[model samples]
Target: MEGTAKSLIEQTSESILNYIITNNLTTGDKLPNEYKLAEEVNVGRSTLREAVRALVSRNILEVRQGSGTYVSENTGIVDDPLGFSFVKDTLKLTEDLFEIRYLLEPRVAALAATNATDEQIEELDKIRLEIEERIGAFSDEHIEKDIEFHKLVSEMSGNVAMSNLVSIINQSISRYYDYYTSNRIKDETIVSHREIMDAIKSRDPILAEDVMRIHIVTNRRSLSQNKKNNLKKE
Candidate 1:
């Protein structure tokens, strides 16, 4: 009995997904009223509600009290999809996170130089200036905009997976900055960001790649040194 009930719920979930696809529903689009949706999907109201709750947990749907259910912003990607917060060693996590960034981001920057649309390039410039405005303050906005700058560069590459992966790593990177951000890197990032923008703006893929590589290496060095200094005090 339990097995059959669970299968039904799973089948209903698939039906809901199919309905979303068939009707061209997108993020922020409201699902039909429960009675209508259940009928359309050929499921009972209780089954449809159960399926919707399951999707909500997977970050695929959201239910707003009194408003109705809608598709979530990131579709189905959870904020901590990799479970990075479980790691106890902050420094080790930082090192590994940067390793992934180092592997993927330079090539992404190279592609952005060749592939970015004019509007995306302009948006990149806007994010860079937003970072510049928040510089020296070193507040959350500054760090956030800095992350946005990198994430935008990935999107400019015109690779959806690359963009999403960068965003995933960015969640962990944001935490690392909360503790380890240093003055040197803060200044260096502003300079490096401008250099990256200029290289991409000029459509120089090789220079953009080289510049991004330097930026990543420089950040690893700064954070490693900061970690060492903190350890010495302890």
Candidate 2:
């Protein structure tokens, strides 16, 4: 607890984030220099520089060789919402991504059911409940959690190489998952997750595979729905 509190209090990155948020800063907005920021956050200039570097790695800010630091163009003000890289470049290519996930994840679920430990199943249950609790409230905000649940299942399947592959795919498709989950008026995902969980708990590999297949199909249907909605708007 002490460590957690101290970490929170000393989080220079978080202080910078709060400053940007409270000031309603936009992309391309020039932030104050390190000295000024250090004074404002009550941190040393070195600490402020470190935080800025971290944000730069996350694509939230940019520093030119000679020019002062500025908010990145892709940081959501002059670009896609929430700094979505996919939206800024290839939003229409997500169908290919979903196609691949559908091809891969059913097999992952089957393997997980066959190989996972009881403790791993418990972790799955805990994650599912957390997702359910957050349903209808910032549904898209927990995209990372949703990705994590699937990643955990993949890792628990006792197939390290496959787990690594799934992790890569998860990172790539995360933005789409966030956008997809947020746009839906009804979250059918919780039910789909429950079915997969039940199959895993029963240790029925075939059943788990079949349920997971259906879950991916359901996601495709949601994607289709979103496409249709977009057409209607146009």
Candidate 3:
């Protein structure tokens, strides 16, 4: 009987989670009343309360005096790992990190052009060609090269803060890339990188910044699309 109750509670929680996601519900969104949730999930109010209590403990929901239960402000992509059970929510957090990086990296490129040493430019060029070599043949190996190229550029900026920022952003982006870029569509990404590399190699700061901006913007759009595609498949 205990096991049966636990199973029902688990299923009920999952139903709530699925509903939140499908409806694009976000943080601070008010949850339906206990009676409503019970009706929607076809469970008793006692079971609904039990499940809601569990989620409340997990910081997924909050109950106010007369305001009713609301999805906590920390509920969605910003949800803490310990407080959230969904992997998709975790990916949303990752996407936010990437968005921040997208905003910062082009500035890093512009600074690198102003600050980089001759040897640094040479190093950047080397990685640029290496990345070009693996255009149509991208793999995990190429991903590493791709990161190396950016890391070298970040270091060339001679700004410790920018370098560290780039490092974190690169790491976050790497996770998304691993899932989104397979052999099926590697060329598109490789071509984009090549365009940026061309501007970098020419030492045109304005052009380099523009190219990098385009690349990051395109990448963010692509990643968002990939997430949607994965959801559809699921």
Candidate 4:
């Protein structure tokens, strides 16, 4: 009887989790009322509460007094590992990181275009302006601001998983950053950042996606050119 009850509660918890995912619930979104949720998951009220408690423990849900359960803001990503830090070959590591960024960031940008509020877009522009200023003055803080711009773009995407994942990369792995900052590259980077910001601000997802792709491709090309020039001098 004890084992059967445990299994039932586990199954109920999983069903609740699937419901949240299938519905695309984001942070702060309210879950169904307890009675409705219990009925939907084919569990009794007591078992449903137990399952909810389990999810709350995992930082996946939170209960508010006199309100309702909501998707937790934390989403459990804070302590996730920095994947590229263990990589030994900096060159290969950067190449891999670029590939991941290429695959993920354009979509992130597009989502940001669709989801970003006017206030968030304005904040993003502020970050972009700060980056341009620091870069022009050759202040190393520009590096931090550069990553800040990307992190803001990620946050605007409205996808908690992608936002947190990108934040992890920006905060931990800057292997490819600052490797190729020639005069031409800096000028082009400023232009590319502006293009990306403009696209998102206009709420044009397709444009956002295209410009972001171009931005990454331009950086890849600059890295390649620098490598070739270095090899020639060697």
Give lDDT per model, in order: 0.87, 0.75, 0.71, 0.83
* TM-score-sorted candidate list, best first: 1, 4, 2, 3
Q: What's the lDDT of the predicted structure labeled candidate 4?
A: 0.83
- Candidate 2: where are CA atoms >4 Å away? 1-89, 176-186
Best by lDDT: 1
Give the best candidate by TM-score: 1
After superposing candidate 3, which stretches have Cα over 4 Å from the reference? 1-88, 135-138, 176-185
lDDT of 3 at 83: 31
Span of ten consecutive residues with least summed lDDT in model 2: 75-84
User: For model 3, which pairs clash?
Assistant: none
Residues 97-141, model 2: lDDT tens digits: 678789889999999999999999999999988877767575555
TM values, all candidates:
0.91, 0.59, 0.56, 0.64
Lowest-sum lDDT 10-residue window in model 4: 76-85
Per-residue C-alpha lDDT of model 4 across residues 88-113, encoded as one tens digit per residue:
77666666677778899999999999
User: Which 10 successive residues of model 1 have the least lDDT summed?
Assistant: 176-185
- Name every residue pair that clashes in candidate 1: none
Of the two candidates 2 and 4, the one with more favorable TM-score, higher being better, is 4
Better of 1 and 4 by TM-score: 1
